[model samples]
Target: MHYIYLHGFASSPRSTKARDLSDRFAALDISLSIPDLNQNDFSHLTLSRQIQQVEALFPPAPAPVTLIGSSFGGLTAAWLGERHLQVDRLVLLAPAFGFLAHWLPRLGDQVEQWQTDGYLPVYHYSEAKELPLHYAFVADAAQYQEESIARSLPTLVLHGRHDDVIPLQASLDFARTRPWIKLVELDSDHALTDVSTEIWQAIQSFCAL
Candidate 1:
């Protein structure tokens, strides 16, 4: 089985969770791809192109591909699975399905400032401080409505109980519509800091099936 690890928005392949997951999979001699999605020219790449890059990294045999995506990457994984990629299973961690709904409002003032200043301020959990602006522009992008994607593939969703970013209800709404989806609630925040073992166990069980 092949696995792909996708990091969240404004996050790199070097994230704590990514590194931990990589180490766990590596110990099992399983190959996984955790690419650096933090391109300075992210605005220039279309969503389709981003998906293409991910697909190109995998074999073409239509084998079962397990996708583990966090935040914006989860949204991208759902979109890819629905439209083009042949994913056997998916694990979405605090996915940002309502990106436009939530972020557009918060970023309303910063949008113009980013356009004018050519960058916007962002926070990095590792740095524990404010950082310079990084930009990602989605053009005529289709939303990843969880219900729509869940209809096609078996998915496992893990969300924090106290998640401040993407609400737990979004995943709950998805589970309501798609009976194949399983939800595992945690006590951590949006980053899912302390539940790595739980997440890995869930993945192992799903892969066994």
Candidate 2:
């Protein structure tokens, strides 16, 4: 199976988890591919566009792909696994379902301001700059009803109990209906840094070759 890891929004393949996974994969003599989702301008970033970017990485009729996606990327993987039959397994870290529900409340009146301005300036840690995300992002994301997407693949979801970005309840709600999904709660926050070793072990055991 081919392995690929999708990093969170405003993050890159250089993230701590990405680097750690790469090193672990090397030790296991495996190749783990990580693509840059935000290679284009943030103004052009949307769920549809990001999904298309991931689609472009496939080698024609190649080995089955096992996906590891974090945050927004985790949501991306969830969508892809539903649509693509070649996806064998999924490991999601703080997958962002019902994310706008959480974000909109935080943005509050800024939602109206962003729609009026056409874009919102969000700080991108990797770029060290505030990037412009078009209001189209919110609209595009709304197109995909999270619960409607199919998720029959072998899946594991790791969510931080203290995650301030996306709520732990989102995963709990889904896992309740879909008992096949293994949801592991971590003591860490959205970063999931505190339980890195445990998460790594789970990944290794889940996709053991």
Candidate 3:
């Protein structure tokens, strides 16, 4: 089985969660590919671009893949699973479901200003500074509707009950209709950083490691 780890938005392969999970997989004598979704150009990020980049990294055919993603990356993983039969399983950490709806409101007036300016300055967790991302990011993301992901597969979602970003209800709603998904609620927040071990344990059980 091939393993791939996709980090959250504004984050990188060096994120605490990514590195921790990578170490855990390595301890099991397995390699996890954590690609930089930014593609060295966060200024013009798009969901389609990310999907293309990660799909290219997938091992040729017959080799089944297991995708592990966090936040926006988790959302990306779900769509990939829907589009590709090679994806065998998914492990999502606080996925950003209805992300635009939940996030755009937080930006408030900046949303309109970003449209007018064609860019918005947001904090980059990995880069440790604010980065100007093009408004095209929002335009591209709006094209992907969460309700369209109907393909069924073995999936596990680890969401924080106290999550303020992508409310817990999002996962609950998602798992409600999809019997193949197992939703595990944790005590942490949106980051799920405090319960890394629990996440790893769940992955091991779900993946049968």
lDDT of 1 at 11: 74
Give per-model TM-scores: 0.83, 0.96, 0.98
CA lDDT, every model vs. true structure: 0.74, 0.88, 0.94
lDDT of 1 by residue, 1-209 (tens): 67898888767688978998899888888888897665544434345555777777666866767888998888778776776546878889888777666676778787777767765666755446556643445333443344566446788889999988888877787678677878899988899968888888877887763
lDDT of 1 at 10: 66
lDDT tens digits, residue span 1-209, model 3: 99999999999999999999889989999999999999999989888898999999999997999999999999999999999999999999999889899999999999999999999998998999999999999999999988889999999999999999999999999889899999999999999999988998999999999
Candidate 3 ranges beyond 4 A from true positions: none
**Candidate rank order under lDDT:** 3, 2, 1
Write the candidate numbers in order of decreasing TM-score: 3, 2, 1
Off by over 4 Å in 2: none
How far residue 39's Cα lies from its native spot in candidate 2, in Å, is 1.4
Best by TM-score: 3
Question: For residues 1-209, what per-residue lDDT tens digits would candidate 2 score against the true structure?
Answer: 88989999888888989999889899999999999888767666888988888887865675689899999999999998888888889999999988788888888899999999999998887888898889999999989998787667799999999999998999899778886699999898998877889899999888885
Output the worst ten-in-a-row residue range by lDDT, candidate 2. 54-63
